[model samples]
Target: MPTDTVRYGMISTAKIGINAHIPAAVKSHNSEIVAICSRFDGPAKQAAEENGIGRWYGSYEELLADPDIDAVVNPLPNSMHHEWTIKAAEAGKHILCEKPIAVTMDEVREMTAAAEANGVLLVEAFTHRLNPHMRRARQLVGEGAVGDVRHFEAVLAFTSRDTSTDVRLKPELAGGGLWDAGCYSVSAARFILGGEPVRAAGFAADSGNYGVDTSFSGLLEFPGGAIAHMRSSVEQPGTNMGEVIGTKGKIRIPHLFEEDTPLVITNADGEERVETFAGEPRFVVQFNDFSECVLTGKAPEFPPEDGLANTAAVLALYASASSGQITAVERV
Candidate 1:
């Protein structure tokens, strides 16, 4: 609330916030993470102290009630996303929520509407889109670098050996490989295509223990017949990467969301080129961008509307697997 500061309060000292978000905020010129809230006080205080945050609250409500904090970042579970996001919006704080904004389309709509009605900026934290390479990739794709944009392919996977229970493996918590890693693939395809998917067909990986998907593979059809094939899994190990193939040429973005994106672009003239950003912390870009929107009252380029659209697509894919038929993605 001060003239020289953008005060942020994080709802949880989750792994993401501790390792990335908090540090990023500390490094940003315009932002300072002044408060932190967690269900348990230990991690909250520890993170706040380690990151040089000014205060730590024992509960989310306490952080939300802080008059000095201008923005709240929600890094809670997928199921908790809608609740906290709406709560933040209602409290008159701009929100930068983690993606897959909600597990269901209905909640996504409600959260989006709440942010709009409250006149507070709400943006899903799709850090990939904030990467300078992705920004340029979109521009090149639109300029016919990828010619008609016929198809796209993306994959996100990692191997976790932890036996400890996590929300990613819990259905009730909106956990699943699809809801977790799969959301990234879906969001990436949707981001590159620049439109909502009209339909989806997919298969879920049922490992028998969890009733939810452990892995998923799917195809999405965009408005102009542009199609995408995507795969995500928790039982696998690999780098996170994605590529967009258009009619004339294709672009490949390696280490897609992390810092220092190297973009390979090919044109119809049989020439290939690579572009790289100087180097930035991906999470820093996300925090700085969100802070700007909160301070200036500007709508986010990757707004809550994106959360709704991606949820619709992922939900449609789930439905297709459950019903054994192609399911239509509800337009956002």
Candidate 2:
């Protein structure tokens, strides 16, 4: 292995790992998927062979114990993210954990503290944040192209046919559309608005049998009078759209989360212009970003504190829904 390259051990053979992270890591010049792990031996062996990984481990502890592996991609279930991430950090393995970071802010703080104490990087894998288009949108907003940013609306929804057995449908596993998709909307709003929300109010519909939220709609109030509306549903047709409106102009992202897409900006003059970005797999970009931070000892663009802020906002939304009152977002 090259001294400049990061040898990665994948902690799970989950769909996201197999379909996105593995391929992304294989394509990254600074990253190598040296090993993959699954609790079951058969799946671990199959993933290793299918993904061209050098080795397979039936247990996560085995992969973590490997000295040659520099990092681990933790795409485990929501409930397992905190535990495994802490363990990975304790093992001196940099981690790219999946979104929402954790179901609660306390868990996020713990994971971040462990990583800091162990001298390992722990980044929340919000792939959309790595997209050039998203970065450009934020730049435009910050530059006042959308003057006096006042409002935002984002929706990310998808219909799930396998709700009965999907991990996303289990309450104990922290399954819900809000945690799965709504977090993206909330995080995007915070990013575009340039601050954390001060208050949040929302409503959620539960999956009767599972006691998990199938749909949620929320409103967040940021400092300086900026407001955002976010919606997510596991029972609706897929849609990904985000809009940021200001006094002078507005920006609309048709495919907010997708990698290759055009951003439409409309000004007060009723004139509109399109901004297009080079198509790059966001997962690949995310992995490369993590690799750069690991190699250079630089803090990640989206660090654990940002993850905690996002988690705090989401938790406030949940509290609002539960209490039927506007809930204050706890600052990290």
Candidate 3:
């Protein structure tokens, strides 16, 4: 705990944990993956060995009980997020949880309460928001480059590589395009808008007869006459992009989640320019940010409250999709 780097114990060998968090932690200057835990012994050991981590545990309890691990990286399934995150917080270790923080608002609140009670830091891993280009795009909006936000467009769509065993397609695991991919679009919108949405309306499609939604188009009405249109799908693969349309100008964000996607700004006078950013990967930025907060004992730049609001917004949209009615987002 006295060192400059945070020793992170990854909670699962899920794709996010293995594909993103582990690599990012290894690349980060302020964070290191000292250990990884999975209920399965083979995966935990394999991932640890493959990633050059020092230790691996078959059970989460054993990993959490270790005194060497300073924090936990939780990329568990959406439904399991609440339980595992609360457990980590209760164990007095900081947590970096994946997006769509929990299945319901109550669960997010409960997890937040547990972290607060235990005096541990809990951060939601929003890769889109942490993307450097997205940060610059937000700055441009704040500087009036977009000129009075009017409407926003965002989409994250992809066809499932394997529908047979992918956990993202299973309803019991809270799998859906909206929860899996749409959350990024939702987060991008809220990040740029800097305001909580008041109303939400959505329509979901269950292609391939998957029993759960495979694609969805959602609408969020924010204050001051600004609105955001978000689309996400696992059945339709296309460009994942964003655009901020304002009264006087518009910014075209090609691929909002990518690391080096250029931002095109078109002003009212028909001037166009492309801006690119140079920095670490989105995942790396996220890990280092979390580690910085842990080391400095400062509140995270985007705290659990932001996660609560984002989850509330996504839930409102999903609710509207199910009921075929306009749902009101909880004002957080």
Task: Report residue 281 deviation for candidate 1 (angstroms).
Answer: 1.7
Steric overlap count per candidate:
0, 0, 0
Model 3 lDDT on a 0 to 1 scale: 0.89
The estimated TM-scores of all candidates read 0.94, 0.97, 0.97
* Residues forming the 10-long window of minimal summed lDDT in candidate 3: 126-135
User: If the candidates were sorted by their lDDT against the true structure, best first, what order would they fall in?
Assistant: 2, 3, 1
Clashing pairs in 2: none
At residue 180, candidate 1 shows an lDDT of 82
Q: Which of the two, 2 or 3, has more lDDT?
A: 2
Q: Write the per-residue lDDT of candidate 3 for residues 1-332, one digit (tens) a residue.
A: 95699999999898988888888887899999899988989999998889899899999999999999889988888889999999999899999998778879999999999999999999888888877788888998888887889999899998899999877888888999999989988889889878889999999998877777898999999888888999999988576999999988999988887788899999999999998876779899988889899999878988899999999999999999989999999877
Summarize candidate 1's per-residue lDDT along 1-332 as a digit string, tens digits.
77666888899987887877888887887888889989878988888888888899988998999998898888898889989999998998888888778888788888888988988888878787777877787788777778788878888887656635776887777888888888888988877777789999999986757777878999999988899888988878776888888888889888777668789887778688998786578788777777777777666777777788888899999999899999999876
Model 1 Cα shift for residue 129 (angstroms) = 0.7
The superposed Cα distance between candidate 3 and the true structure at residue 245, in angstroms, equals 0.6
> Which pairs of residues clash in candidate 3, taking residues 3 or more apart in a chain or in different chains?
none
Q: Clash pairs of candidate 1?
A: none
lDDT accuracy of residue 187 in candidate 3:
88
